[model samples]
Target: MNLLRAAATVSSYTLLSRVTGLIRDVLIARAFGAGSITDAFWVAFRIPNLLRRLFAEGAFAQAFVPILGETKSTRTTEEARVLLDRVASLLTFVLIGVTLVGIIAAPLVVSAMGSGLRGADRASDFDAAVWMTRVMFPYITCMSLVAFASGVLNTWRHFAVPAITPVLLNLSMIAASIFLAPRLETPIYALAIGVVIGGVAQLAVQFAALARLGLKPRISFRLKTAWADPTVKRIMRQMLPATVGVSVAQLSLLINTNIATWLAPGSVTWLSFADRLMEFPTALLGAALSTVLLPSLSQAHAAGRKEDYSALLDWGLRLTLLLGLPAGLGLALMSEGLVSTLFHYGAFNAADVAQTRMAVIAYAVGLLGLLAVKILAPGFYARQDIRTPVKIALAVLVATQCLNLIFVPYLHHAGLALSIGLGACINALALLTGLRRRGVYVPSKGWGTFFMKLLVALAVMGTALAGANTFIDWLAMQQHAWLRVGLLLAMVSGAGVVYFGVLFTLGFRPNQFKKGGTPLV
Candidate 1:
């Protein structure tokens, strides 16, 4: 089908998830605020989240999707079905073990990620974190399975299910914050309970979607039989380097989390809230486009359609700049307003908004690069080439820590965000260069003009935001919550209109992005 439409569909669903997620965080901030307890919960949640990304979404999807696409194209229907069952069997077997280990070693895991939690004054926070970690540890099992189903469904061109299922988790958290947190002796435990419930809900929905397509795996417990399958072995082998690549990113997160723990009491929570805001554009544009592109790119490779392959990458990059730049400019210029509008409420106060705004601005600096990496890395993943990106990621990881040393001393937690953003830009550049040198991706014509037009649009958007920032007192308007929300929405929407209105005048058409043939599944 039309790739742009697929991306738009995924983006639309993702926006719903993001909206619900923001509400979840808003409820959280109102109830709990950015404090030691919230930091504890965020850190504890990171453990299972780390495992899910490492084993399923990050490494596993990168490795599994390409091979599954290849299998669907080259093998019979029965062969593909068998491949799915065996892969599922092997994955479930592995993640179960990881989950158990995580539960039993919850204390060590929490300490490793956030050592500062162990101080005598923070002993309660440390214990609470461990308790939550154990409760949420099993979340990875359900989420990993969900990720498997998502990759399978996306490969089958069922993008809406995977994109929207995340909303279940957000809703689960929101419900717990409202209904469960108040009744509990330890309210934070409600979030952990919510995490498990959400994971299971998401897993259930994903599997149901798979069943609708009759593509659900017939999971087997026979590890030997699954391992003996050549396709399963290939996925595991591909995961080797893919895991390393993903690990580099996770490692940075682990380091940053630990650093945040040591910086200030609310640093982790502030950064987390800021991160949720940044994810709006990221999930909408970067993730949506990449999800649609990866399968199509794999199809192009399988069919030996070189021109189609390059054009798809070009189209994704153009869309990245066209939309992502305006988003970044809005975030950086009006960060205080955005943060205050969304988060300044009951428990969350002016100081928290100020701190969160700093991180948002830092993150916005690298939004384009972050979006670019999402688009470019899939270029290698679709070709079943994970090593180049892994090597580049290792270097970026090193550069990030070095930048952290230089910036954190001055900028505090925001420095951690700044370093990560800068590192992502470096990583994207290196990936683009590698793709060019290897002749895997060639830049299409009009790139120069494309960027020039995007720059002009971004300048206009930035100017509008600067004007809003000066005239609007976001922190002072906290008492007028609804009015602040209305004003923020109007300013962002008006600026977005000015941005895209310029692009339209400069001749950027939706038709240019309407490339890619019917998806091959």
Candidate 2:
């Protein structure tokens, strides 16, 4: 696959999903705001989301794809089909058992995560968390299947359907929030219902797409067949290390959630909101590049095309840095204005906006680190080497947990954001350094020059935006809040124009960067 072409396709769909998600979040802020219910809902929501990233997107895809891609490349179609069926059967069995356990332990899980909520005035407050967790527990089962289908579709070179599936999930939640939220006694329940419906819908969408490609998976009990398959054994081998790596990250997040429980009633919600905001850019640029790069790199490595593999890795890194750096700077500089413009309305008040803005700024500081991990991790995964990342991830997890312990008492929700950012930087550095030691990554002479130019352009853009924001604030003092929003939007647009224009004039071809050229921006 053409790496640039795949990234564009996935990025476009991911961009759409992020936009719809923003709308959903805006509506959620309007309805629930930052309070006990929002906290309860977010805590419940994070359980599935953390699991989604851990088991489905992170470990499963990282482990399954290389094996699947190799199978598709080396074996006959019939042989690959049999392998898929066996693996699917085994996955179904495991996920069923996991989901049952999750449902049974929902209350204990919620209580452990949200011990801070016990101080609430009403006894029902604790029950809300339990209810929401149960409602959303089945989501894990559905989405795990969806993730399996997505891995299969990705191997078949049908990227659009898998990339677009998340859009359906976001839209389902949006619809639920709009139509069902007001009618439900507790708005959290509406969001929970949306999670279940969305997960099922996501699975259905992928199945239909697979059927169109004549690759439908049959339901079967073939655990013995899967366990005996050599390919399955190899996948399991890869999965064990990758699971450790993903679990380290997930455990760090769980630690953050636990720390947030002691901060304030809405501390968890504030952290969640900030994370969603940062994820908008991360998902669009970082995730899009990583998702597209993995299969391409895996193919190149499998074929022993070292140059192509290296080129793709370099391209992914440059694109991630170019896109991620500016976004991080912009968010950090304009956190307050951006947060106020987007969310300071309805049930979300000025105080909530202020708190979330601080969290966003803190998260912004680590955006490059986050994107770096996204870019560099694929190199390891594509080489079918998962243990290195697992070791690095463990170190980063310990660092993050230590930071959370030290910072949360002083910085509140923002402390969690800071810890995550610091952890990402550590993880990225470890991955890059490991790749260098293994001779997988050799920085070209042009790297320093490219980075220097990109830094110059970023400085110019940041300065221009900061100035523009000051002017906008001065003008907004004499205008309505809506007018202030309009002015702020104009200021942001102007900043982008100045930023890209300067880079282009400085001999940077944004298009070439997208196509894997040196990062000049």
Instruction: Output the number of the TM-score-best candidate.
Output: 1
- Predicted structure with the largest lDDT when compared to the true one: 1
Which residue ranges in model 1 land beyond 4 Å of their true spot? 516-521
For candidate 2, give the lDDT of residue 64: 93
The whole-model lDDT of each prediction reads 0.92, 0.83
**What lDDT tens digits, residue by residue, belong to model 2 across residues 443-485?**
6558887888788889999988777666555323333667767
Model 1 residue 476 CA deviation in Å:
1.2
RMSD of each: 1.4, 2.5
Give per-model TM-scores: 0.98, 0.96
Residue pairs in clash, model 1: 1-518, 1-519
Q: Ten residues in a row with the worst lDDT in model 1? A: 512-521
Cand. 1 TM to true fold: 0.98
Pairing residues by index, what is the TM-score of model 2?
0.96
